[model samples]
Target: MTLGHSTRLIAVAFALAGPFGLASQPSWAEPTQGWKSYIERDYQAAEKHWRTDVARGNPNGAFGLAILAERAGDAKGATEWYEKAALGGVPSAQVLTGQRYAEGVGVERNPVRAYAWFARAMAAGVPNAEKLRDRLAATMTPSQIKEADALAETLAKP
Candidate 1:
């Protein structure tokens, strides 16, 4: 069956659900040709496509930009884009953003923020996110855990 534009867009949104491992690209998944160019190693074309999508407020575009920035060793830019995508409700971006916070990559090291993002990712059904959140919780003080839980609650998608 032919997928509608919205359905194709939904597929694109979830395309990064795993670790940069999009094995095959469906023919109709070209609204954000960024992922296609990215897989083909055409960084320039990917960036152009992603930038246009980002301009149009596409979270998947933000996720694509985050991957490109990370590839270029621009930790700060990657973190910014990842956070944008995460806030826009991209589960993979939430995980990456959590890791950035956990590792102090491009952002200050804050276990609280890491836990919060991980919790959000877990709630969004990202596999292994609960493990990440629990692992981080093991190192945090009770008060910190409480704060992280509160933050995660506040940031939960409606």
Candidate 2:
């Protein structure tokens, strides 16, 4: 699907949140209160906390929501939240988003987009992101690679 102007703008903003076009790694030592609630199987409490965080523009909140959605078997909802978190500079979300794109789990499979996300994740120091990107690259035609490269370059701009 072609990204609209606002979507592209959001993508650019997300790209700006990270180093080399993706957000830096977040500290996982202190899980968000929402995440804590989720771990305790308090779905209602976790949703409330995560909703508040999302309202406050906290990407981790989006990440938490994604997890909750996944747990509840909402593949589409989970993917949407994951994309939001990834754009907001969550490295793990980026990888998840990339995987989703690669496999067409929630969204349509788009190798070019998948590669771009993987590139961003790799640049952000995500483990094995490079390997994933390279694997995807192996399946892409030269022109497709060029397109992915261009998209990655655009996303990399601060």
Candidate 3:
């Protein structure tokens, strides 16, 4: 290798080695350009890109696949991937999961659970979550709302 490249590689290796050594360094996965493929209207390529990370529980891959599934009219597949991404901490996936729960789409309708998911999205800094939470709250009775509010607070905690 060139001296410059070798120096950079050495620096990176040292950086990756922490106080606890290499074992303490965070593991990284390869770049998966799933979103780019999906945006280009290429479902096949998007699927291929995203599949590389799905087994590793990458939220971006799950979220991209969810969008692709939805575009292809596969509600079941969409919900499944949405749930995976949501659990993996994707804010959009959390919002979508909330909507699904509220509407009984590919899952049971449960407003309380929906509210919690919305709150979780809000906690994760998804700005659209507030409106959805407020709208859903309007349909609930005072007691149900209290429960949902409590759930929201609980879900918001780290």
- For lDDT, the strongest prediction is 1
For candidate 2, lDDT tens digit of each residue in 18-130? Answer: 33332333443355788677667788999999899889777778877887777677889988998898788677777778888999988889999899888877877776789
lDDT by residue for model 1 over 105-131, one digit each (tens)?
999999999999999888777777888
List pairs with backbone clashes in candidate 2.
18-22, 18-23
Candidate 3: stretches off by over 4 Å: 1-31, 146-158
* Ranking 1 against 3 by TM-score, winner: 1
- Residue runs of model 2 more than 4 Å from their true location after superposition: 1-29, 156-158
In what order do the candidates fall by lDDT, top score first? 1, 2, 3
Report the C-alpha lDDT of model 3 over 90-129, residue by residue, as the tens digit. 6667787788889988887999989888877767666668
| Worst window of 10 by summed lDDT in candidate 2 | 16-25
lDDT of each: 0.77, 0.75, 0.67
